[model samples]
Target chain A: MKVLALDTSNRPLSVSVLNYDKVLATTTITTQRKHAAYAMQTIEDLVKVAKLKPSDLDRVVVAQGPGSYTGLRVAVTIGKVLSDTLKIDLVGISSLLALSLNVEKEGQLVAPTFDARNDILFTGLYRITSNGPKSVLPDQHISFEEWLKQLDQFDESIVFVGEDVANFKARLQAHFGTNFKSVVGIDNLPQAARIGIYGEQQRPVSDIDTFVPDYLRLTQAESDWQKLHPGEGHESYVEQV
Target chain B: MKNENSLILSFETSCDETSVAVIKNGKEILSNIVATQIKSHQRFGGVVPEVASRHHIEQITICLNDALQKAGVTYSDLTGVAITYGPGLVGSLLVGITAAKVVAWAHQLPLIPVNHIAGHIYATNFDHPIEFPALALVVSGGHTELVWMPKEGEFKIIGETRDDAAGETYDKIGRVLGINYPAGPQVDQMAHLGHDTFAFPRAMEKNDNFDFSFSGLKSAFINTVHHADQINATLDKNDLATSFQQAVIDVLVSKAMRALDKYPAKEFILAGGVAANRGLRERLDQELEKRDVEFVKAPLKLCGDNAAMIGAAAEMLQRHGAKADMSLNANPGLEFEWAENEEE
Candidate 1:
């Protein structure tokens, strides 16, 4: 099966064309907010290098959010349009899971994180299982201090992955000591190939129109509205007004 | 691709409107689809950047398909792709940029980056081509500026607002009157119903320079409303709206007339969101008519925000070989730089 996958949920924008489990062509650009400018050209070039047209793709996979709001929207928009336009199966994967699955260590706990500003991180804990990295903790947006406290309760060594890990490296090392091992390199960046592999294991979205990026946190405006109207349903300010 | 046969597909998401349009030779708009998120933002009293970005992503492809279908064209027929890259919300602009980049790359076409404010000004060309030495009054929610165009594709910003844009001031004052988000049209309607009872202060009115200041006017309007509220005195909403609108129009017209005297252009353009105002449009028409200058305003439907104007701007850019490579990125505060004169 020919699969085209994209990951722009974080700083690094990755695009890959794959045949089944093996990767045919992949490009990873480690630039901030360049997703909109570079993702399509990379995807088109990758597909062309692999000698396939957009219509020949069997499935489309993309990294669903909980990271940069604009970055995630870039990839998700392309993914949805390509999949829906070509009438192909569309699959969405957690961005943090894609970063964690990049770790090759077996039985190692992977805690992939993306900086969420204000000392918070969009992160989740995963354990490398026989099949792949299984989620030990679901994706969430929490402060680094809180997430570190949760990691302290774990008994095994944790492998920190993702481009933003360096931002909290000193604190991570202080907390985990010898048990914490850092995986820092180009390979640690979120890869579309990983997204494609994991997407195969998951079910495709039944309705493409209803699918949206999984922005874990509400926008500032939405939050402000919520604070003003306590315990109100999430019907949006426009509807309520 | 050039000339009358050239087909440009444009994307515009610099604000709450997600628009896509297919234009031929820059002037003929075959299809212009604008999926507005005004309702989604009305409750928040303004556009929420995140919501605008999300909606742009969801509607971009649909708008793209509709534009192509309505134009009776296909990707193969597209000569180039165009998009508004900046001077608005970064998040909102990125969606259109990404979508346009992808479509252009997939089809192996040149990507033309357009300025959003320029697009607003260029909307005047939808039915009629702009004459050379054109003077434009660009007024929108985010901008209030006077641009001088010596020739086609040449723009120079001679004057602009230092504080709040005219449309922004309208919305802010509209909130005081308990109106919905995007108070420009609502306030204009109310202004038409009542007379200007209170003579509001026209900020920077007597200034020698063309630069404007509306923050003082906004403050005065807010303070008056609050003072009235404190005394439990009822205020006429129409009169307040009329008084505020008159103040804004007074300053805008004064600055524009000053520019006209300095530049002496043959053509005058009323562009952007506030260009739809009944008072401003009539005032410019009457004012420009005295000078024997052709007065052109963006059609009411195209005045808000749409991609058709972007398509028109792209056609102009393509003539100058202003193609954006893969390194093109969205600039939230993008400025229009005329490269043609520099090369000359």
Candidate 2:
């Protein structure tokens, strides 16, 4: 089973072509705001290096949102189009989970944090078990302080994984001290192989058209409009307006 | 599935519309699917870039599938993938560009990057072939420019708006009337029903340069309505719309005629979203007829952002051997220039 996985939900863009559990080829490019520019080209290059045609791929996996909005759209949009066009299944993996896959040790908590700007972070907690990473905390958009407060309950040492880990490293140390640990260097970046493996273990989307990026937050316009039309959560902003 | 007929799949997501098309050879559009977000943006009174990007990603795949299925063509039958790569909101443009790049690279098909304005100009070709040395007046929500195309597929910006675009000005003025978001057509409709009452200033009409300035006119219109409200005077909505539309049309027609007189061309094509304006189209037709220059008004549907136009422009690029590689990025300000320096 050939699976093509893509992860551009963060600063580092990663693409991997895998044959079931075996990795055939993987490519990564670390450049901010260059994911959309390099994403498809990297995927094409990876497929070429793997000596396979686009049609040879059986499934497509993509790291869905909770990271950069444009970056997530790049992967999800292409994944949907490719899967639909190639008549293959498409699976969406949490970007937070993909980041957690950077942690190699078992019996440790993998806490992936993506900077959401203004001191807020899109983060989640996952436990690294022998059977892949298991979700311990659902993806949430909260302030760093609030997120740290929620993590106080876990007794195990936590390994924060993600490109933005460095940004909050100092604050994280102040919060949990010795209990808080982070993977430094390349291991911190999310990889497409991780997305592929995680997706292989998950179910494919039943309807490709309905599947979209999991943007945890609303657009500024929508948020503002919602504020004006208070208590109109059930209705769409357009309809309420 | 490679055959004598080369099918080019195209995408356009420069703004609130997510469009996909399958064009056979350039002239024939097998299928053109446009999923517009106008309804979604109507509440915002204008296009929100973030909202537009979100819609494009969601609608692109569906549009692509529909375009292919409607055309009854498979990926193997495709000759290339063409996409509008710029002169649009970055977030919106990236969705289409990324989608195009992926499909092109995945299938090993050539990718053709098309300028949005070029797409609008080529949209007129769906009805008839554009004559060389054509002077095209491109007007849309984001742009208002006079492009001098000396030969087929060559573009030269003769003049452009210095301030608000003609369509943008109409929208801003239309907001006072509580009209729908895109006010070009609404103002045009009201213009046909009422007389041009108020004398709105037509900026840069007497100037020798072909450049336009609509900011002054827009402010004048806004001030007129606001002043009337202060004085408790109820102004006629239709007359206001008529006068504003006339002001815009006067400036546009004047600049276009100036460009045409300076550089005589075989054809004068009116393209872009504002080309759908009834008053502007009629005026251009009358003037071009007097000059004996063939007038081509873009089809109302083609005047807006769509993939068929991108497909048409891509055909010209393909003929000129202007295939974009995987390195092509979505340029927010992708400009077009004359390609006379390149070999055919």
Chain A vs. true chain A, TM-score per model, equals 0.94, 0.93
Question: What is the i-RMS of every prediction?
Answer: 4.4, 4.3
On lDDT, the candidate that comes out on top is: 2
Query: In model 1, where do residues sit more than 4 Å from their true spots?
Result: A1-3, A27-33, A38-60, A84-89, A105-109, A117-119, A143-158, A163-187, A200-206, A230-241, B1-4, B337-344
Cα lDDT tens digits for candidate 2, B1-344: 57686689999999888899999889999999988888778768899999999988878778989999999998888999999989999999998998898788778899998999999999998888899899999999999999989898689887889988889988899898888788888789889988899999999999988889999999999999999999999999989988988899999998889888888999999999999999998888777778968899899988989999999999888889878877778899777663233232
**Candidate 2, backbone clash total:** 0
Q: In candidate 2, which residue ranges exceed 4 Å CA deviation?
A: A230-241, B1-3, B338-344
DockQ of each: 0.39, 0.50
Go through the candidates in order and give each one's C-alpha lDDT. Answer: 0.85, 0.87
- Models 1 onward score TM values of 0.88, 0.95
TM-scores for chain B, listed for all candidates:
0.96, 0.97
Compute the lDDT of residue A24 as modeled in candidate 2: 98
TM-score of 2: 0.95
Candidate 1 Cα deviation (angstroms), residue B230: 3.7
